[model samples]
Target: MNETSNNTVIDERSDILETLAKHRHFLRFTTRDLTDEQAGQRTTASELCLGGLIKHVTSTERNWADFIQRGPAAMGDFKNMTEADFAKRADDFRMLPGDTLAGVLAAYEEVAAATDKLVADLPDLNASHPLPEAPWFEPGARWSARRVLLHIIAETAQHSGHADIIRESLDGAKSMG
Candidate 1:
């Protein structure tokens, strides 16, 4: 019987993949029915905007997925990044004049699909990679694929909260349905 046909036999990916999908749904929900400009609006003192958060999470997930395949070297000299490189990375979170809610949302969905497929294909979540050198991270830390997946979930959850507050402040729209 096909995996889909055998509903009684729970799939290995159900826990991590399903939970992440639910959170991604909530994050995408926060942006619904908003114009491009509205999506880019910052109603609070914090710099976060809904569209920007979408962009940030999309980029963050894609990069981390690449790291899973390519390891710490894929992170590429984080310790030596200049102010301009840092500035450029920071700008990814904001919706520039040309950025649209639809575009960011589309990119996010693409990342989601790719990650779900990756999880399904992996033979061992225990596969490990050395973390890049960063002051924000502990020295010589290594993360297994399972740990990386969990970290992705954590990042999404935190950003979802930020998006919710920003959405509410923008137009009194609550995300918890």
Candidate 2:
């Protein structure tokens, strides 16, 4: 490849990697130095908790990487799926106590690996994928594989921000400099 093309590829890969790193960092941050109760504790009135966030992220990764991309979804996708019917399974996404920190992290890693492989194998970022759950998603939209990856990254980053605040409230731990 020419220097310009090489640089662009490098920049794109770097951006993707950085996004993944940030997600991993926050997962670790949220789980750090917490008792089992604290990890599972719903610190606020909302459904947010350190463990729940981890499970939610894992599910999100599987959705974007597998359901949207037409690949195999990791086991963590079923975190809170018992109450869901077949139709509800198509749209329901929540975390349950069964989704322990370790299990969720492992599932996230598996989905992340699949995501990396998908990105690497794609011929270009413009490559599009079919949306089986299209109606449940935004209006007038199908997503490219690249778009799904970026969306996962963006979603993780946003949840990480929430994790940061919750972690602080729990014990005042700051992000590493």
Candidate 3:
């Protein structure tokens, strides 16, 4: 690539990574000073809780990043899971037995580090893979690495909003204030 192109690549990766870091900061900030039980409390009518949202975002981003590295099938075989199996996957959001806020936060940091590295190391953001089949996803779709990063950002920001509401409801504490 030419010098200008190289600079643009660097700038794009830096921009995405910085935005992800900013969102992550706010997400973690919302969970501060919470016991495991408190983190799992559902403060709103929705099933979402602060701890659950944390786990969900971690898993989601990790899976997408892995997809960027290893392709869509890296997400695993979900074609024939039993209803009970599906139920357990659904519980991935909750702070289940043996789960803690600290553990989840630590895992998030690890995933973020690995994902940022992958983003920087990729030759081009245009790298893509066929998306895994899912009920919500359109059939035969492909997602570029750039799209994956954007999705992660969107997911993180969306859950951050949910977490903000849950956190404020839990103890009347604002996430930023």
Best by TM-score: 3
Full candidate order by TM-score, most accurate first: 3, 1, 2
Ten contiguous residues minimizing lDDT sum, candidate 3: 1-10
Model-by-model lDDT, in order?
0.88, 0.66, 0.89
Candidate 2 matches the true fold with a TM-score of 0.74
lDDT value, residue 34 of candidate 1? 98
Regarding TM-score, does 2 or 3 come out ahead? 3
Q: List CA RMSD, all candidates.
A: 3.4, 5.1, 1.7
Candidates ranked by lDDT, best first? Answer: 3, 1, 2
The digit string of per-residue lDDT tens for model 1 on 1-177 reads: 554344432354678898899889999999999999999988899988999999999988998888888899877788899999999888877999888899999999999999999887776677899999998778989998778888899899999999999999998899985
Q: Candidate 3: deviation at residue 86, Å?
A: 1.6
lDDT of each residue in 134-158, candidate 3, tens digit only: 7767899999999999999999998
Candidate 1's TM-score: 0.92
- Which residue pairs of candidate 1 clash? none
Off by over 4 Å in 2: 1-7, 71-98, 130-136
Writing each residue's lDDT as its tens digit, candidate 2 over 1-177 gives 543267786588667877787777776677776766676666555667777777677767777766444532322333344555454443223345464567666777787777777666555665565454333555435577667778888888888887777777777775544
Clashing residue pairs, candidate 3? 52-93
Error of 3 at 34 (Å): 1.0
